[model samples]
Target: MYRYLEQRLAVRIMEFLRQRYPETALPAVVIEQPPKVALGDFAIPLFPFAKPLRSAPLKIAESIRSEIGSIEGIAEFRVAPPGYLNVRIDRAWLALAQALARDHVPKEEATSGKILVEHTSINPNKAAHIGHLRNAVLGDTFVRLLRYAGREVDVQNYIDNTGVQVADVVVGFTHLVKKSRPEIDVLAREPRFDYYCWDLYARVSQWYAQDKQNLQARSETLHAIEAGNNETAAVAETIASAVLRRHLETMERLDIEYDFLPRESEILHLHFWDAAFTKLKSAGVLTYENDGKNKGCWVMRRAGTGKSEGQQAEQALVQESGGERVLEEEDQKVIVRSNGTVGYVGKDIAYHMWKFGLLGQDFGYRKFYRYPNQHECWISAIEGEKHHPHFGGVAEVYNVIDARQSEAQSTVIEALRELGHNEAADHYTHFSYEMVALTPRCAAELGYALSEEDKTRPYVEVSGRKGFGVKADDLIDQLIVSAKSEVDSRHPELGDEERRSIARQIAVGALRYFMLKYTKQSVIAFDFKDALSFEGETGPYAQYAVVRANGIFNKAALDADEFARNVANKIPAEEFSQFLNGEATDEIWELWLSSSKTSYVVNQCIATTEPAYLAKHAFQLAQLFNAFYHRHPILSEPNEKRKQFLLATVAVVRRELTRTLAVMGITVPPVM
Candidate 1:
């Protein structure tokens, strides 16, 4: 509702300006919320128009105030000193509109094509850790935000099944553990297979450090896995498939789902790189390095550093120096090594080209995993089902990777642009975020031994290769145990299973919210106490606010929908105005205003590619409702109209809070 009013007013102001200043050019009008509610609901600065109109800002403000006729949902406009237009909305009308409105799903805008969001691409070698959790949760929440905004989104989780990580795990099982294929198969069927591999992976890392000769095994295993159809490749497939299943189960605990899981193995066996290499050569994006440190390799200029004139000048200088000049290797990124192996960036470029339908190749899809909700997840296969849903050819793509991969992501986009797919390159997004580390207190609580230096530091980075991080399953289990203990103590009357279910909900909420509360660029130091707290900017705090609001409706013996209907039927706009106006009812009015901005907040989140703003929105709305609950006596009011108005306020807040939490992948338990 707030966004609607802003757009309406902006259009009205623009139309008025065009008619008044026929010869002048105008800029886009932006609307902002006032600092205080008493000032007004929305503020529009007139300073930008002064230079274009060749007049003082105060005069422009006066002209707008006089010429801009009455707008819908707006009560009046006031011009402040110097140059500001303050808009006061009709409170009664807004309250009535909100009470009568259904859910706050924003209207879908027309889009050119489907959006592809690739997230949670954890390597299929070991158990997922807290660092992986941040990637998955951020990606999942962004998918939710895009879907909620009425965009067609395809969720993908890339599986690096044939990568060096998988090769290392295979080496661990065969060389260090000395286990045969059949022996490992039996163990893979056992519980916590991924956890077993996690420890083995760390041991392999240690073994490599003890003797440089041991590194040769990793290289041999990688080549074997890439070749396929051999015992080593089969073993690699077994371990990666098992670990990938465990990953899916862990993410499902937090309500994250994917539409497709494309594997690196298929990309290799299907010759995706062969096709991409052809295109790169035909487009002249790849150049052969005949000399220098990168001799006998296929290289390309780094993204944003491609300057033909400067390259020609450097080459001329080198020739003038009697062909003895050495080319700077740092300015070039190697796409394919001299040993005839394509680099990670080369494979990624092929995958992204497929994503935009420029590769002229498609993955064969087969049903691989099914969620409890009956959603089917497909995987890339050599021979897939004859009839399957299409997976590629998207109009836009978003890769939710860590900040460390920014350069690789940029190279892929640069390749796209060089290949003349500038539109796809322009639409590509690297939704990068910082890593997650454990706070010193959190590490100690998790029973990790810390050095004195580590203890003094603010955060401890998790190293998967060293097996020194919190596993995703273990963290979820620990959270549930802690939450269940609290639930058991607080609600002794409830059955064991009911308490357990509520605890799971709370635990998942805590985990997802903790992952999302920080901005993408901000590194998070995970701590149990901060995440599970019931007060102050935590998921539990927001969930509790919803539970408490529901309690009000329960105590009044009224269904929220029926209460809204009664308010809309019994109360008039004038009565709402009388009830919501002045200093005495400022808090109630503020709550209504906050409830109306859920769609606005969602739009802001999508535009900025940041979910932290929505997290902050939910927390702030929760804070306002909690304060209002303590200050206002809703059910016991003497005046019937005022009581109905207050109940209507509760209904609106309850609905919006629940919706907001749902979008963040958090569920409100029946009781907290």
Candidate 2:
């Protein structure tokens, strides 16, 4: 509401500058809302352009204020002690704009092209734990915010079907259980497929440790599966495809949806890497070395880095498995290894190249899943070469990988830059976040005995190899149970089916918000007791606040439409701004002023990849609504015009809060 007030004031200032210092070139005008509401609604600091003005900043501010004289909707104006122009907006304009914003927002700013957000691309080997929740919640929220800002967005979840984690589950089926493909398929249909594989995969990891020679079986299975020509690959595919399907169902339970499910196997078969290799070779971007530690390898040098960089990267690989990293030549990466095979990073680079349309090749897409709305859920592929919707033209690509993979992501960026597509490289953001850990008590609750080393650790690390983590299905069941108690306490008359639906809504709200409440940099300790709580500083509170607002409006006996019309037709015709004068304010005005800061909040969250910023904003809005609700009455107020204004104000709060929570994938239940 005050944005125009600032704009008008800035124009006046520039005009003053033109008249006072005619020879000076005008600079860009930047107006900012002050840190506190009482400090005036907006401020302009002139020190930044003072040198060019050839006058003191304080004098310039005063001169501009005096020369510009009075402007519309500016209640008051003054120059601060430090030479900032402070301007307060007319309180009634805020109330009017807040009411108008809902019905009269510019159409161009309300809808725009979709953004492709790929997040929570977790391996389909185990349960979706808190770490996975953080990625999905943030990604889902990002999609909502973009859509709210009028941008089109397509969500994606990338499945790494041929990765080591999936391979371990395959090993568990073949070597440990000695189960055939049909038996494995039956086992996979159980509700606990991800859970079952979680334990089995961990056991397989331990089995390999017992005897070094046992590792050969895993290597054999991996090779056979990659070769795509044997029974081992068939069995692996059955288990992988089955378990991955289960993963999708779990995500659906969390209300997460996707536009595409791109599989790594499809990328390999599509030979995206083959095209990428040809381009690199033709461009002389990759070279081969025969007289080094990695002899006979088609290689590229380690991409150039600052002197202090790549040290932790070099140390981490050495510390883990003593596996060596061989530079391709100088500032390049090996597309294929010496013994004849592609590196994991090589396939990923190819995928990135293809995403940017740099590969000059595309995947054959096929409709895989039938959505409830009958929309096609597309999957990228090679075998099922059917025509589906377009798979790639992404305006932006986000890979929700761990920070540990920064080196590989950098290689992808370097490849794009070398290909002369700087925008593609620049647009690719490695949306990295820290891992989740199990609290000591939670780890103990899971029946794991701790060594002194474990006791001294900051948090119990989630080890895929050990299956030491919370399962997504397990958490969802618990959330539903937790939510039911609250629902039953509040509305005992609700039918069982109706209550269950409401409880699930509450469950999603509680879980998504909790996952996003903490700053992304803060490591989660996967505490069950803390996660289960619905009271204080949780999603339920935010939902409860909105629910209360809606209840007030519903019980007020006047529709938002009637209330707005009544206020306009029957209220005093002096134009409320004329009476708000120099010092008076309306609470509705404060709500409008505060409510308008959402775009900045959304951008900050996007730039920082931290949902906590949004979480804080949501909390603040909830607080504002609550305080406003206590002091103001709608239907009970005998003054008809005042009553109508309150109703309209509540309506604005309700809309913005809904949009804000939706941006974070937190659905506000109508009843709580």
Clashing pairs in 2: 112-150, 113-152, 114-152, 114-153, 300-328, 300-332, 300-333, 301-329, 301-332
Q: For candidate 1, lDDT tens digit of each residue in 286-362?
A: 99988778889999878767658987798788768876334556668999999889999999999999999999988
C-alpha lDDT values of all predictions: 0.89, 0.74
Please provide TM-scores, in order, for all candidate models, with all chains considered together: 0.95, 0.89
**Model 2 C-alpha lDDT per residue in residues 1-672, reported as the tens digit of each score:** 444455577787677678877888878777887777777888888887788977888888888777777777676777997878888776665556555563333456554334578877878777666677777777777777666656777778888887777778888888998897788878878877777888898899999999998888888888887878688877777777677677667777777778888888887878888988888777766777766565677765565553355876775666577443442234446668877788877887788887766778887777767657676667776755555666666767777766667778887787777767788888888877777789888898988888888878879887777877777778988999889877888888888888888999889888888888877667888888888888877888788888888898678655644555455444343444543333444454567676765665776677676668888888878878888888776668887655655666677677677768888777877688
Off by over 4 Å in 1: 102-108, 307-327, 444-456
What does candidate 2 score on TM? Answer: 0.89
